[model samples]
Target chain A: MTVAATSIGTPGDLVSATASDSALRRFLHGLPGVDQVGAEARVGNLATRSIKAEAKRWALDLAVRTIDLTTLEGADTPGKVRSLCAKAIQPDPDDRTCQSVAAVCVYPDLVAVASQALAGSGVAVASVATAFPSGRARLDVKLTDVAGAVEAGADEIDMVVDRGAFLAGRYGEVLDEIRQVKGACGPAHLKVILETGELATLDNVRRASWLAMAGGADFIKTSTGKVTPAATLPVALVMLEAVRDFADLTGTEVGVKVAGGIRSAKDALRYLVVVHETAGAEWLRPERFRFGASSLLNDVLMQRAKQRTGRYHSPDRVTID
Target chain B: MVRRPAARPVRGGERLEVRKTYKLYVGGAFPRSESGRSYEVLDGRGRLLANAARASRKDARDAVVAARKAGPAWSGATAYNRGQVLYRVAEVLEGRADQFAAEVATAEGLTAARARRAVEATVDRWVWYAGWADKFAQVGGSANPVAGPYFNFSVPEPTGVVAVLAPQGSSLLGLCSVLAPVMVGGNSCVVVASEARPLPAVTLAEVLATSDVPGGTVNVLTGRTAELAPVLADHLDVNGLDLTGVAGDAALAADLEARAAENTKRLHRAPGAEPDWTAAPDGPHRILTWCETKTVWHPVGT
Candidate 1:
């Protein structure tokens, strides 16, 4: 499927009706509250399902193809971005069959470098903008951030929502910002990051997910990788359920990108299991689900090598990016 | 007064002993075997002592992962800091001397006095190695008198993670003899405790846990040595293998040595048999065995 085709079309009546502050607040508040214990219990149970042999190999490959190989550090250099792009294109240099990752996520300033490096590699260049991890900036500056990245050849833009506004029950303001950023993205797909770690509750997570989708986000991301509780299983479970329900209501299949602290093949496979169980098998593709991670790629590659060699692999053999 | 007249016969007591359930130490936490397997540990007289976790190959794999995760900080710590941590472990071991002596007495069928002496020796062995942590480099490394205009020097560095097989005959002393040297060189290790006598080792694990030593620095796995040793020897991440515990089983030692070659791992081959761990001081051979000499050269006048 094409990347552009994944965008959720013009907001439906359900989204348009919640244009005002009270309407949006009431709409988000009226949604069902999450049962914390049940969500955690369900995730814990699903984590035990063993994906082995051929199924494991297939899962590993799918995980590789769905990764947003990301480097959003303040110290990222052109050399590092170029190297990350190279690793994304060929995760396992020793094996020719290993597929390239879906995209390379970087700071907006490095979008051009990543874009040029990944030009013909069938790997999209994703840039994080809108003051990125903080999301504490003027609206015009935020829009310019999005514009700069989109103009610099970013195929996808990851924008963080203002947590202060959202936490103060200013749902319409948050939605308005998301819509503006979505507009500024132009052709680049918009991934609205809720930064779920700071949201403080699963209820807030669900509300934020709906708010972002209503504002025309093509994807809803979990965190900014700077928070402590980024992209947890229960949080992801709540987001997945929201996406599934939103798709049911508006026929929009917004993707979910869980970033931060998702290292190890075991954790990735658990996430795949949760996705399959929470949001049907149709959302299993890269167009619907993604992992915004840095170290996760090496772990997936190591597991892949282990399966093929019938022996446990070591980190020494894999490239450290 | 009439009730007191009825004399109750004192026969069996109502209290029952809370037997300890020994679990494997990995990543600084105590977890039962992932396979949910446990084996009956017998005392010297072949009597049921307690149940120790029978670690599976997956447990060994987890230990390696933990060791690898904890490797960098351990190897990067200053030599003085490593020595202090090792000394802290010795301090904790000494504080729990009587408890270890009892466990050793039961596991190895030693008299209370002999077990106490062994525990003291083990604590002393830790202190002895702890003293070498900061000084081993000075002894094993040196300035080369090369016939050149450039100045050159060599320094000994830890060789990543090492896997140790604790001697089956002497539970506490032998385990310390092999484990202390490895850590003295800043190498984290996964120790497969003496399969037949693991009670003391598990008790020692508790000591290591309470001490200042980092978790995963010294993981203690109690299970069939035959089952866990091969897995560790074959692990590509394990940089060294000390086969001292498997000396009694020549065939197993030979097989482990062969597997260790897959990664060209430094192998401290098993002696002809389990040596007398109570013997007097040996040189720093065990510590140097797990160290890699890094040589640096510079022009004399730069």
Candidate 2:
């Protein structure tokens, strides 16, 4: 990890202890603003790339491997968690060609249950903490929440950023909150959620992206799935660009996780194309790029089955997680 | 150049024929097959006519979505309004009589006169169903004299979305026979057209688009029934299946019926041998096939 305690005048250091608050503000504001129309046009252009036949088959399989299958409902029960875990381990019972997903994400209370159900399976157990969808709780409470999930065997912690703080121009406070959550995560990787839906603007999204990376986030995520415009293509494009630029400056690779509203194999493939073109092939792997979704896996599996059998697969055959 | 002809001289009668490209009808728009695959449709004489969209299972799923999206408003439409819509479809089909007759003649190897007669009968079938749209409830629903001091009545309501397998042999008449009745009851449908003769089915979709019938109310897909039927059968969103086309194939019908049991969808299967679609009894059976009886009770004394 790159140290935040560095000289202020260093060219690429985003977080320097010697830099005054005004200098830090200038550094963030000095970052180029996004051209919304151009970015969306570029995303739309990339979405038209036709990955057919063998390439499509490969992309479908890789998309299945990149999913962090999530269930964040308040009515979540042990039975539901167990079933989701079972689905994560063996997505398609009839087709062994389907791979286990990257992880199973759930509420922190069910972390132990998911961990136990997914044991011996390579699928990691991810839990949403830090008061989850809304990071409105006290910093101590948020840290405790992260600690509890980590103590319960959560292999990855998906923590939401304090949007109110970030929006109120308390950038230092937001950065410190992420740092504390990272410290609380011990061995588990920390995924800092920017919740771009509430971030208000693409410039804010970019600034938050840099802030999260500087605060030592292992992965910068797009949303919590509770907001209206969660994980849109333009927002995802900006986040991907942020990670690419961060890697150039700090030389530390931070991952990206796009959550919410992605529901089809076609949509997943489009996101894969964006990653392939913008972030290059290195982020194409699950370790660097992930899709935080619940319904996207089944669509991918269905497409994979279609590719294999030369016909469409029935939705009833797959478990309805 | 001695005498300038009254009209420009025609070079060797080499006029270019603009062959129509058939596409799948979904959610009111005409789109090519999502799978980007098409099958060659040949005339009975083994001559190529046009390439018909070969819809895949994804297309079947999309049709289900469209049917579901169109179901609520369609089922809630006034019976008289629905009758008007059906009559409008008949009107539109009547205007395109020669095109349909030519297609039917080419597809089925029928004489021109016989094909024109079939087209006329198909148009009449729509009119027949148009009248039934407002009458099925009165003819089918009833009030029973209950033992208790409660007034009970059985009313028929549309059963949401339906999937229809149009008859394979009588492509035009059989298609109109199945489609008109199912839609007359206010139930939206996704029809898998006759595999060997799909031209008239898509042509019928063009007619429906111009009629007063709402978009997504009737989605027609042309492709292999064997490949597309199972997906529709297993679709949980579909409320009913009309297996009129698979009447003779007992094994295929049984297989589809078993899959439909996943959602407990209502099934309407035709008996073996093609039915006389021009007969008078076609109206009640097809409409009632997809209607559910809801019984509501009211106390006698206010």
Candidate 3:
């Protein structure tokens, strides 16, 4: 039993410590209950603000995956995605940036290609398997997808929840299927995406959070990007709270990813601030955190370059993947 | 010599006696089976009071839809409000104790006074469930710790619609025993009321309809027990089931459980061993059951 020594830190600055603990506690208390924390914590202290130069640069490389089993709808999309991967991915495996991209997401079909392309790089090759976006396919198909992705050297597998099964209130079916998929992932990380906009409620969104965690999701992602109203702070906050609760119960920590449509350094920093107040300093490290976005890389790199050189560079001048 | 016709079915002084036919309680109305089907209900003396509603698969589904319509608002209701409604149901049951006693006496072969005690126990069960309406979550839920800087918690949530088999003996008390816990936790249930002594079951439905209990939270379906139990148990949408009503049918109850397993529905089958109707309560039967615990978490940062 790993008893967490409640290192509820005591700084001599009673006001600041009180503020920090209460701020943290308030975020913790508000995490459940389905109501949104309308205002983001504006961390203005000199220490908090120095503040986060690198966190502002975080972004997730999502796989808006398209699998062509029959090659029917968006059948040729995989090959196009491959070209984009080769173009946008770091061709040389030796280069390491100030931060790793969130993940190089791909379909199980091209996990091999993306794995090979991203080989020897810290950028995790995340595959969208287990019936991506729409998980109506059979359980065997979903398990095989997880197995195939891990077999092809995927570092992480983002599986979509069976929206059809869950919405029908076949919660046991949904939970069991996810458990099977997580087991199939072997050592590879599992991220369960709720595809929230389709779920349509903050209450349901919260419930799905616990279901995914209970189902062995190593991370709970916000959306599939196939749906609208992609990534919002409220949804991300709910997912973050889910991870914290799971960690407390099992002593196994979860990772959180806010993917889809996150495009600016400002938004990235906002995510980091939310995390800092909700989780802690240790999560500030990129290993536990990721920003999934196709467009966030350039903007973050642009900001990083500006921080280093004391001046912002032209977007064309930055080396972006 | 011609015996004088009875003033009521009661062998002694009893006002508000139960009718012969036991019917389904749907939408605040007691209606005979829409299917026009009824099976004979035999009291302890083996005399028929009336027929009971042979609740069909369609009736069960329609009841579920009604329950679902009422579920959210009912579940969303404050725990205090739910408790108040449950207490009100008890009050309604108390004022009509004489009617319930006759029904129970016919249903269980009890003397009038004993039947009154049994009905009071049934009424008391509502008060018990009412107290738990809001507190089920705090007791069952927890929080989790994830690696990230975020807050999280797990809280208990209602599993939506449920199906119940009201206890066969102790008809009034057992029916209350099954129905109170389900509705107390904010889930609506369709009960296949006891076939042997269904008069009280139908009478109890009338009591529920008037207590502002909402139309669909508790539904009583009286039919051939073997026929209706499957329809409720096998229902894919029915989230949970109770078998307190089937006292001697272990094999059949097991079969129903097996069928319910298709949806992984939570099954609670009270043992054939008759519970002391006057006892405190069955832990599983009397306590709130099958709550979904949702834990939330947040990051602890300096």
Best prediction by TM-score: 1
Q: Candidate 1 residues B172-283, lDDT tens each?
A: 9999999999998999999999999998888888888888788898899999999899889888889999998988778999999998998899999988888989886688
* Candidate 1 interface RMSD value: 1.1
Per-residue lDDT of B112-195 in model 3, one digit per residue for the tens? 888888887877777777777767666666566677887678877777777787777778887787788787777877878777
lDDT of 2 by residue, A1-321 (tens): 111223223434465631455655676676778888888898999999989999999999899999999999999999999999999999988888688999999999999999999999999999999998998999999999999999999999999999998888877788778888999999999999999999889889988888898789999999999997999888888888878877766678999999999999999999999998887899999999999999999889878877886544556557777
Model 1 C-alpha lDDT per residue in residues A1-321, reported as the tens digit of each score: 111112323335455557678878777887778888989999999999999999999999999999999998889999999999999999999899999999999999999999999999999999999998999999999999999999999999999999999999988899889989999999999999999999999999988998998899999999999998999999999999888878877778999999999998899999999999988898899999999999999999988987887557789988888
Ten contiguous residues minimizing lDDT sum, candidate 1 chain A: A1-10
Shift of residue B138 alpha carbon in model 1, Å: 2.3
Task: Sort the candidates on DockQ, descending order.
Answer: 1, 2, 3
Candidate 3 lDDT over residue span A141-194, tens digit each: 889888988998888888999888777666667777888998999999888888
Q: Give the clashing pairs for model 1.
A: none
DockQ, every prediction: 0.52, 0.17, 0.00
Q: What pairs collide in candidate 2? A: none
Candidate 2 vs candidate 3: the lDDT winner is 2
